[model samples]
Target: MPFLKTAKLSAIAVAVVLSGCSFKEDRNDIVVPIIDAQPAQSSKLQFPQETQQKTKTVPTYSYTVRSGDTLGIIAQKYLGSSQRYTEILALNELKSSDAIYVGQKLQLPTKGLKQPDELQSSNSNKKSSDIEPNKTYPELNELVDSQQYNQAIQWILNQPELSNNVELQEQLVELALTQSKIYKRQQQVADAETLLSGLISEAPLTQNNQKALISELSTLKAEQELITAKRFADQSKFDESYDILLVAWQQVGQPLENNILFTTTRNKVSEHYHQKALRHYRSQELESALVYWKKILAVNPNDDLALVYQDRVKALQNKLENL
Candidate 1:
């Protein structure tokens, strides 16, 4: 009885001492319990954190998606142009018709538009003081408001008022080239992540470093999903991809708008859409297919494939009208 009482007293003394040091103990406590009671979610939590940090290196804005938020509205609110929504889709890995649930995330960037500050200032420069829409702009900010920044500088070269503003026109061309360089820099990170995925193996491994590997692989998996979605107009059998690409074509439609970065690969996207349109047209989706072909011809007026498709679209239009 004496030993039992002494043992109980000893246990109580030990508990009082341990509780004082419990905070320190928790620093290393229960790191991914080996017991099957709670599944290891540490890696799941770390994956998004790492990817979010990685994207911060680019000139992008992070937006937490709210209910009823479409990429178009986000673009209009953040970038001032609803037309730049593809930039949102590319950064966020959203699908054409996936119907974003509440609590989704998005990334906003300077693609196809100016910074928010610059957009506001552009409007200030173009007040009633300027008589002509085509007045020569010494700086990129001139005459470019939020809604028009995407088209503002380029409009100078085409407008009648700026016909003699050769010096300002040339400056706009130089800055357009700089924007292309920025675009390439953003793509480099995406490419590096793709390469990392190929190097990492998915084979089951020891628990020691599995958590780290799982974290890396989850981000790579999301990147792969986005890249795959980029390749098709109807990814996941949705019909919205064609319209998305249609908007992209319009952003860089005319040869006048094409710069070093956009010019070299100008035909690439157009060509991709041209074939996608044919595939859809053959399936009897004439309107959808014609929509794509028209976008292709927007960039290249004489594009032969689009020309052929246009003729067919006209014939179909006539037939439908007669019926």
Candidate 2:
């Protein structure tokens, strides 16, 4: 009985050891599933991070057009180049450079656009070695005072140091205006127009200054037309004179309206045409008379004399055709 009881105790101890081994193997299977689950979660988290790292965005800006704002001026202010005006034009889908109006909004590309502080810093850097250290404003004034206009202009334009000098720019504009007047006095109309136009484009002029320059240029062109028309009239080329004056009257009538010289020349040319028309009318050349009458009416739609004569010549032409 004692031996049987000892054997039974040994058998129970072996059974307990086998069950403990099976429990350890089940725990390992559960832990492996948990470890594999961690790798799937890590991959999902890393994918979003990789996608976020790959994405990027560019920036853009908007600008409002102010009075005296030009594409060239805007480009120069923002892009550091007046030549980039074409880019502005393209961005805005503008067919004409003159299409922008005051208060109009424009989209500006931020790429390469310089901030005001950056532009100033660049100017400061440029001033260090690019300009003549000894050149001064007083010396420039001396050139203008001596009436060395060409040299003064060259100095103002060629000096990069004067790029940000507003006072010097104002002086350059005034000097250009004075020189243009001298050219006009010398009967150099083309030269005067060219000088004013060049200053308008090249110099950083204020709105009022630019407007004044444009007005002067228009007046110069009108005066040149008057001179040319009178020359043609003196040669008895009434057709050429009439055509030239007509174009001037149509295109630059506002500027010519206040010009005494233009008005006087226009009146003289009109009278010449009227007299030639009268000769043609007296000779019964109705077609030729009508041609001159129509030219007068084209220039001055309110010309009572031209209106009556045109009516009479047309009536006579109809009468002759009917007979």
Candidate 3:
């Protein structure tokens, strides 16, 4: 009986040792503490709003009916010139030019109008440094497309190229702007994934690498915004302005003081509105035409087309009233 008990105790010890050896260190189980946590969204990675409100406001007036206040004098004071007698007559609802009464109330009108224009500088040193880039970009594209990419690249990479070459400058400006934006975007993406880098304490030993993959994906999305902005600008140029503004529009956010693209585009668009106003007058849509004409006059009162339409409409309305 004593021998049997001793044998049984030995068997128990062997069973315990065997159980420990069979126990596997769960290699398949994963416990990722570093939360891959979804990538954060930023407003910068969004489409910038287009179509800002006009900054200029129409002039308001407060005039007094002083003694010996003649219409010609009123025109000169308010209109910046005394030759606008007609404007005063129209504003005051006077039937005759000679009719004048003492102590009468009159709100004067200015026959002349001036609107904001592109600001200019006469300083030569400042002027030389201000010019658009990408002037040669289009030409370079043309050359490259024609199987002369090496020559095109070489010309663009010139150390001291022509300053007056608008096309070449335009391309360089656009490329520079795009590259800068991309670099900034990449930096932001890297910042967003800064915490993920800590998870890879020792790289080669880990078999599962899902967290690394997620980080890379987030970076790629940030890059998409810049590409999207460029594509939209390109599309707008293709549709409305064409090659006239394609490069300039893309380089708009750059540090370009001398760039005429913004002013040129504004002028081109304003001219289009005036042209539409003229067409409406031709179609006899007088009231609708008048509204567009006013906008044109507000932008540029000196426009002959707007002036012609304005006079013709006034005559037609006067004739109708007489009948």
Highest lDDT model number: 2
**lDDT by residue (tens digit), candidate 3, 1-323:** 99987775455434434433211212112111111211224443222232112121334243543443444434544576444545654554443212333333444432254331234455434432233333435666565456443354346547255344444544433333233334445675553343234223322212234343333333334333434433544454422442323333333322221334333443454455655665664444567768766664443333334444455566555553444
- Return the candidate ranking by TM-score, descending: 2, 1, 3
lDDT of 2 by residue, 1-323 (tens): 99986775444334435323211222113221100112222332232333323322445457766654556557667887654665665565543312345455566678889874423455556521132222467787677667778788778887775657766666666667677778877878788888888888887666776777777787677777787888887787877887887888776654565666655656666677777777776555567878887887566553434554565566555544444
Instruction: In angstroms, give how far residue 5 of model 1 lies from its true place.
Output: 90
Cα lDDT listed for each candidate: 0.45, 0.61, 0.41
Which residue pairs collide, candidate 1? none
Candidate 1 achieves a global lDDT of: 0.45
* After superposition, candidate 2 runs with Cα above 4 Å error: 1-140, 158-170, 187-194, 206-208, 254-261, 272-323
lDDT of 1 at 96: 31
- lDDT: the better of candidates 1 and 2: 2
